[model samples]
Target: MKMDYEQNAKIFKALSDSSRLKIIDILSCGEKCACDILEYFDFTQPTLSHHMKVLSDCGLVEVRKEGLWNYYSLDINNCNKLTLFMMNLVTETKDCICKNKSNCTCK
Candidate 1:
């Protein structure tokens, strides 16, 4: 599998901010409009928009426009892909061969 450094980097960079993480957590519960998210903090609309932009650019979240409102939601497909990638990284059998294996076949 080809590692997408750029994509992963974007995810990490976006998540580096606490506010962005909180935003993601909130969105995970359900889709929310920009104004609903803004209610959680004292930040002005522009600041929240910046964070939302970063999240959207990283593919961590997605937005849909309904009339005049922009609703954001967590991108579950991307999140699942990321989760599987991390699981594979830590669970690959090559690294745990004979250390704890009762049957070692790798020569």
Candidate 2:
């Protein structure tokens, strides 16, 4: 599959923050209510909301509403795609070419 750099960059950027990373880890176990996720952090509700928005915007996490509560969980499909893309980026290569044409002895 073709990788969308813009989308991937958004995902990477969303995960750049430590707080966001922790949120992802929390959701890894299973779906969690917003309150449940907030218990693990010292930040305010609004801050948590912001973090969730960023995660959701990047398609890294999903959200659902039941009554007055909001639940969050990791988007497994997107996460798997991100992982595969990263793996391919590191492992797949056509060839290595020397920059110096005068001394191009690479094989």
Candidate 3:
């Protein structure tokens, strides 16, 4: 399968921040309410909201609302896709980009 390079890059950019990385790690266990997530960080609610928005925009996070509360979780499918893409990118696999280059010296 062909990789969406632009989308993958965007996803990578989303994970560039330490705060967002920690947020992703936190959501790995299971879905969490916004309040519960805030307990682990010293940032303001608006800051956390900004982080969540970035994660959600990148498709790495899933969010739902009930009443006045918002719950967030990892979007497992997209996360798995990223893992597979990274593996393909690093390994000398059949899909390696260099394979298509006729002048590639590392056969």
Candidate 4:
């Protein structure tokens, strides 16, 4: 399947932050409450909420509201799509002059 560069760029941009990456790492184990996720960092609740917004907006995470708390989990399908996109980028066949210029095998 063809990848949407614009949407994928959003995912990459969202993952660029260290805090956000950490959030992803936290979610990797399982779904977590917003309060539980906040415990791993020193940032304020608002800051964490902002990070969650970026992640969910990019389709990298999913959120559910229960009473006063929010639950979050990694969107595995989207994450798999991202993995495939990256793999395709490197694995796809392409002809390049570097094959002859530098004795590379990318021909």
In terms of TM-score, the best-performing candidate is 3
Candidate 3 is scored at a TM of 0.94
Displacement of the residue 71 alpha carbon in candidate 2, Å: 0.3
Write one digit per residue (lDDT tens) for candidate 1, span 1-107.
44565787778888999999899889989999999999999899999999999999888899999998999999999988777656655675555435457787644
Q: Compose the digit string of candidate 4's lDDT tens values, residues 1-107.
A: 57577998889999999999999999999999999999999999999999999999999999999999999999999999999888766674443334445667564
Better of 1 and 3 by lDDT: 3
Q: Give Cα distance to truth, residue 105, candidate 2, Å.
A: 11
Worst 10-residue lDDT window, candidate 2: 91-100
Candidate 3's C-alpha runs over 4 A off are none
After TM-score superposition, the amount by which residue 82's alpha carbon in candidate 1 deviates from its true location, in angstroms, is 1.5
Choose 2 or 3, whichever is better by lDDT.
3
lDDT of 1: 0.84
Task: Give the clashing pairs for model 1.
Answer: none
User: In model 3, which residue pairs have backbone atoms overlapping below 3 Å?
Assistant: none
lDDT of 2: 0.88
Candidate numbers, best lDDT first, in rank order: 3, 4, 2, 1
Cα-based lDDT at residue 9, candidate 2: 85
> Model 2, 28: alpha-carbon shift in Å?
0.5
